[model samples]
Target: MTIKPHALKKGDQIALVSPASRPHSAEALARAEAVVEKMGFKPIIAKHALSINGYLAGTDEERAQDIMDAFSSDSISGIFCLEGGFGSIKTLSHLDFSQIKKHPKIIMGSHENTCLLTAISNQASMVVFHGPNICSVDRVESIAEIKSTLASSTILPPVTPSLGSFPAGFHHTSYPGNAQGTLIGGNLNAIASLMGTKYSAHFNNKIIFFCERDERNDIIERWFTSFYLAGHLKRIAGIAFGEFPDCGPKDSLSMKSYQDILTERMIEHKIPSTFNMPIGDSSLSRVMPIGIKAKLDATNGKLEFTESALD
Candidate 1:
């Protein structure tokens, strides 16, 4: 059964923990705290929220302990990652899935947090969010929408086509069909890294959405094909490709676009898929719910949630 966490209310305490990398500076943390306060929520910084050990927010054990403490604390109504970098995977083994299952509070983040979100959904059976972290939270233009998503349990309406030119290499493929399944996926690199591990996502009969950044075409192709070869792509109801900033081909000789490669793979699997979604590393990025029942209409380029991600 899917566990829906209680919706946020005004003055609810949100624990800000750094499960991945540390913020760029102390100012970044202060800015995030200000933004949270402006949104009418209390921001409680975790013990390791500002600590830095190389590129990570802190040691693996320290980061994991912050997450554990956040979930176990009765005062915290939600948990949000400080930033997404390179250490979340290291903290997985130290996490207490049972504590998360028992608390059942909203946990939200993206990028490196993808690993944690997927694991929590699978292991704790809780609804988690895939969206901007503390750094991106204040940068997002739709702060009100984000607040609503955290506070409301109402089913989302159909997503309208975004008004903007598609990114270079994006294709508006016309696959006329619709499919419904639980939403699962995040950063392509992070998701692929979890392959064969206990935290790897079970894409069977699910709507898988992924995006990448700063990766060469060759590397992207290998990862995309890895999913196909592993039989994960074949069983998915549909696929949604998100913004891939700076993910162009490294060599000019390669004529195949990233979209072309992805399209080919989707065709081979005979799965309905759409590209150029405004999720991931886009300025117009919208918040998406992980582990919620959603409908993907590839024909019209729309994704609708059949149920709310939170209670």
Candidate 2:
């Protein structure tokens, strides 16, 4: 039951929600709504999208209610998270996966929202989006792809090894080969948090992709080990390591960098993996459809979206 959301048509209403944290401010929220309108869809802000409660946009109950309300609403063709922060994990318990499954539609967000994306896709059996939150809809980092992904029913363009779509950085191929599987990934820490839980997306026979920011290589090494120990990555076909900004060694350049850790781990696991494939926090990052099948050609350095996210 891999449910595909219908491609959004112009004039469709896109619900704006704060499943994590509210946008930077009311003004930022306004701008994000404007971005939605500019993309040719009406924006319907959730009731609690602007409610501030400690670090979260609103209480877990409020956030969960807003998400479910939009999913259950026939008028809302898609739902976009306002910002990425710490609340999606908290709101999960309150969510009714049955509601999402019954009314399957697009739910797009990135960063900490990974918790929700992975959960809904796995537990609810529907496609979810891995892309910039609404706050970044117009940012140079993710605008083009966001617009393209929302309306297209065709396959997303392949990310080539030339690294042309990516920003200037350390892009490399860990193992040279090809693999095709359901696209499964998100923020490394967020996805890893659900390792032993029912919410976790099983990695067996999947083309895994994950990313992080402002994290050290050592901690990343530990996360990888944890996944391996949990037997999550033992049979992964391949991996796409997204941008790791400020993840290198500041204490010493000689220390094994982020690149070193990923290179070593991929080689050790014997997985056909590659780094820097425009996953997140990267300028012009690709808007990937999670829970959809995809092909990873590490040798050719081109990751292909084998299926469209939308019907």
Using all chains and alpha carbons, the TM-scores for the candidates as numbered come to 0.94, 0.94
Model 1, TM vs. native: 0.94
The top-ranked prediction according to lDDT is 2
Q: What global local distance difference test value does model 2 have?
A: 0.84
Off by over 4 Å in 1: 138-140, 164-171, 251-253
Model 1 weakest 10-residue run by lDDT: 165-174
User: Which lDDT values do the candidates have, in the order given?
Assistant: 0.83, 0.84
- Tell me the tens digit of each residue's lDDT in model 2 across 166-233: 35444578887889998899899898888888898888999988888877777877787788887766
Considering summed lDDT, which 10 consecutive residues are worst modelled in model 2?
161-170
Candidate 2 Cα outliers beyond 4 Å, as residue runs: 161-170, 250-254
For model 1, how does the per-residue alpha-carbon lDDT over 77-136 read when each residue is reduced to its tens digit? 999887988889889999999878999999988888898888898989999887778676
